[model samples]
Target chain A: MNDYHNRRGFLKKSAITTLASLVGTKIMFAENIPARVTPLPLLSDSVDGKDPEMTVLSDRPMNMEAPAHLLDDPVTPINKMFIRNNGLPPVKESIDRSAWTLTIDGESVKQKRTYTISELKQRFKPHTYQLVLECGGNGRSGYYPPASGNQWSQGAVHCAAWTGIRLKDILADVGLKDNAVYIGYYGKDIHLSRDAKKVVISRGVPIKKALEDETLIAWAVNGDDIPLFHGAPLRLVIGGWPASVSGKWLHTISVRNIVHDGPKMGGSSYRVPVIPVQPGEKVEETEENFRIIESMPVKSLITHPKSGAVLSSNRSLSVRGHAWAGDLEVTEVNVSIDYGCTWQKANLSAPKNRLAWQQWSAKIDFPQNGYYEIWVKATDSKGVSQPMVMPQWNPKGYLNNACHRIAVKVVV
Target chain B: MNVRRVTLAVAAFFVIAMGITCVSDLRNDQTTTDTTATTSLVDTLNYDPHSGLVVDTTLGLVVANCSGCHSTELIRKSRFTRDGWIAKIRWMQKEQNLWDLGKNEKSILDYLEKYYSPSSLDARAQMRREPLDDIQWYDYQ
Candidate 1:
């Protein structure tokens, strides 16, 4: 035993001691630490009320994404909602929902205002909207030389009906100064290192985005207490933007005179290159070269008749999916079965509300009995369309709103 | 039952073997009992199976430093060159308050680059090269 310990060069006892001290409340003794750590659970295993089919990328600072096939529902249920966390969630048992308080303050705020959860619900009129939240790095796996973060496919996006008070109403109550340029949020999630001073992730949007009618300080998702995993007591629900901007477990909102310089606001955290770079080129992360991603790009997903569907030669396939453009409306969606060689427009539905994803469907008749790929493309109100291939590769691989294609085998 | 007889026979054989070994070790004055207890504790305490870290020379360092805050899946899924790994470490130090690894940095980086470096041969890279051709195709209703 002594020899084994001696052979190991970097088993500094301080690492364990620090962790023990940090989680001292939960784990009292060193022996309490499990002797043998178990192997990674099978992906089929589910926890925290999430569906078993959802992919588990990492569990420590839990990050999970739903598979594309499972995302067919228009209003993504709490179980199906993708979870992307920068740090561990606050302990659910310890949270006092009624006593939860949200403070609005910053350099540009005329007056600092604090409201208990109950007070905010009672004083302000409630509104609900089906908001689409997508990770900035959604579809990151398609980037060549793959990105450094979670290898999310297309599952890191969802549309859920959020019920909460308008953020504009709260800002009006607090009174913003003329100099207000941005709004930054702070959440109660504990940092990974358990450093009290180190925030897990604090990001915010511009003041204009904050004042939009759909921007909300939401506490309910699909008309229930926000699940603990999704941010329980309170959270910000800014639609049509990177979900990171909709900070979860929200506790404080700061009206800033300058652009929000919170933890993830700087660097290449959620920013893309200002100019397109070669696929393999390395670019230094700088304010001059990289700019924060604002409204997301035009994107769509074919949710029904999931990829790799097998069908009889005579059967016509009915394809349906959802499309959304950040801060813009999806004007049209087209489907092609001949590998983009020929195209036909699909019937597109109006969004339930602004910033909500629009649904579309089309019946595709196969010309022969072989293999085929169904491709869907969406065009936004600004005349911007989804790229056939991935957008120019940035260093961080932020946005890849390429047309989503699925496969089908037509058997004779 | 015959099963009970077989179980008793196996148990008796192990008991006899252990008795002989213990008696021989006692005569040899080798502290065999102490060694057995130590071995059991080491087996239970030393390794974490769930971390998903490839066992290597720097496994101790990687576990001590990296797994404390996040799962090793983050490392397993990521592919980076040596400089990229260094940049990640620096980011953690600057933003995450990761303590200076000092001399152990080289070993950790070496282990990571050896095992986790970007390669076109990885499963994910292959996935990019070809859409999943092996997935079980289901009948469309």
Candidate 2:
């Protein structure tokens, strides 16, 4: 709760109020990327070269009524990864690789320097850690009446083996300045304001999050180059934070005395309530204010046999899926077959780092599987666990961590 | 200037500024303009040459189908593949009362693929392909 309390004029902050006046004109959100290798399927099911275990939702909806679970591997394969973009997917062309650079120039670093993706890979010892990346709006649609933006269902999080140079590795080289209190990042997503002004969205991570070893300046995913739909070339990988602020197609890193107050940070998006409002209520700034969204809650989901999966035998089955608490270590995971009536602690096998999600496995035998429900709850080392029900909703629809339940059928 | 004169001047200035700002904002508000800033974003967000980002036939089809009711930003921010868009189109037609255009959906999708495919580059660049390590500027340039 530190550094929060800045909701001075919280009231009168409706999206419609802002929508009426609209900020920066709609110059172009981007110059735009053309599609290629087309004349094919509508939804991109081509997760070529990806492992099927980790990516059940990449090609299709998580079989909503069926049971789905996470893979036990630490690193997420490019093809098995889940994507939750708020808009259209951008195409990456080979010619577009004009060797862009990343400059570390925040208040913390001394004698800032630029490094190419290759230079970064070679200059610093390549570090690989398995972690979970979840969208800030993951499970937001469950907000009742739909809180607006992205309208994401459940498929927004992914656990992956992220390989890259550690933020500490780069910061040590840059030499932190004494006055540096925060680290600000700017990505390459460009959108024009209605005022004909070009706006580049910039976000900031507190110095605490930036200095963690698990936080990486990643350029590769799953041993190969990262894919474009994913943050390619290079991106900021915050071990346990909201996905939107991670800034895909990342460009600049600046250390500052205070928070990055660009539209992306202060005025435009990622704002949520510092405290939870009751469930089924719209967060009216006039009544309750919202703050910047940060770390994700401890969460988990079932990935095996699919919800509503009909297994022939009544034997016990292996239950697997990813469990994580952004930046925090998941100490224990609990599963409930009767929808939270009784819970069984799951076995959590964490990967290399504390910040990343742990691949969990558990076993349960169903006596009768007629429209059965399976729910998973995770608790962090900090003693935080996913709640059984949501308190309420906010303007941006953030931090949705109700029990993740899957339904599967049993056939003899 | 007197108090009233100064007040009038300030109000006049605000009005004039809003007018000029309004006209340009109106155009961009409706559509994303193709320019250096946007291209730079394309270049930065992308890993490869980003030649696919250039406006082409695929873009036209996308504009016709996806943007029929909403702005391109609605389609642009989505990170799904061809199939993802199709699911959305199907949802729009079935769930939200969008009419099926027989087969125009394919063309619109093809165009979107060309203009909006996600870039799949390495988390880090190859060593041999490393650009100069000297302190260059951020592509923020």
The best candidate in terms of DockQ: 1
- lDDT by residue (tens digit), candidate 1, A28-85: 3333222211111222233456764576667777888887878888899888899999
In candidate 1, the second chain superimposes onto the true chain B with a TM-score of 0.57
Model 1: lDDT of residue A314: 59
Every model's DockQ, to 2 decimals? 0.17, 0.02
TM-score of each model, paired residue for residue = 0.82, 0.62
Query: Candidate 2 lDDT, tens digit per residue, A1-412?
Result: 0111111101122322332333233312111111111111211344333332222222221111111333334565555566644322234553144486788886567887888877886789988877677777776545543344554545567767777888878888988877877777766542322222433456768888888888888877778777765766777887678775566676788888777665457631677766666533445542136576677778877765445455566546677787788767788988887778889888888556677667777888777745456788989889988877652466566788876766555565
RMSD of each: 13.0, 20.9
The global C-alpha lDDT for each of the candidates, from Candidate 1 onward, is: 0.76, 0.55
C-alpha lDDT of candidate 2 relative to the true structure: 0.55
Model 2 bad stretches (over 4 Å): A1-40, A44-74, A85-91, A94-98, A190-197, A279-288, B1-141
Reference contact recovery of candidate 2: 0.00
* Per-residue lDDT of candidate 2, residues B1-141 (tens digit): 000122234444544454344323122111122211122232222221112122444444554555444444344334345665676677567533467867777777765554444321111112211111111111110
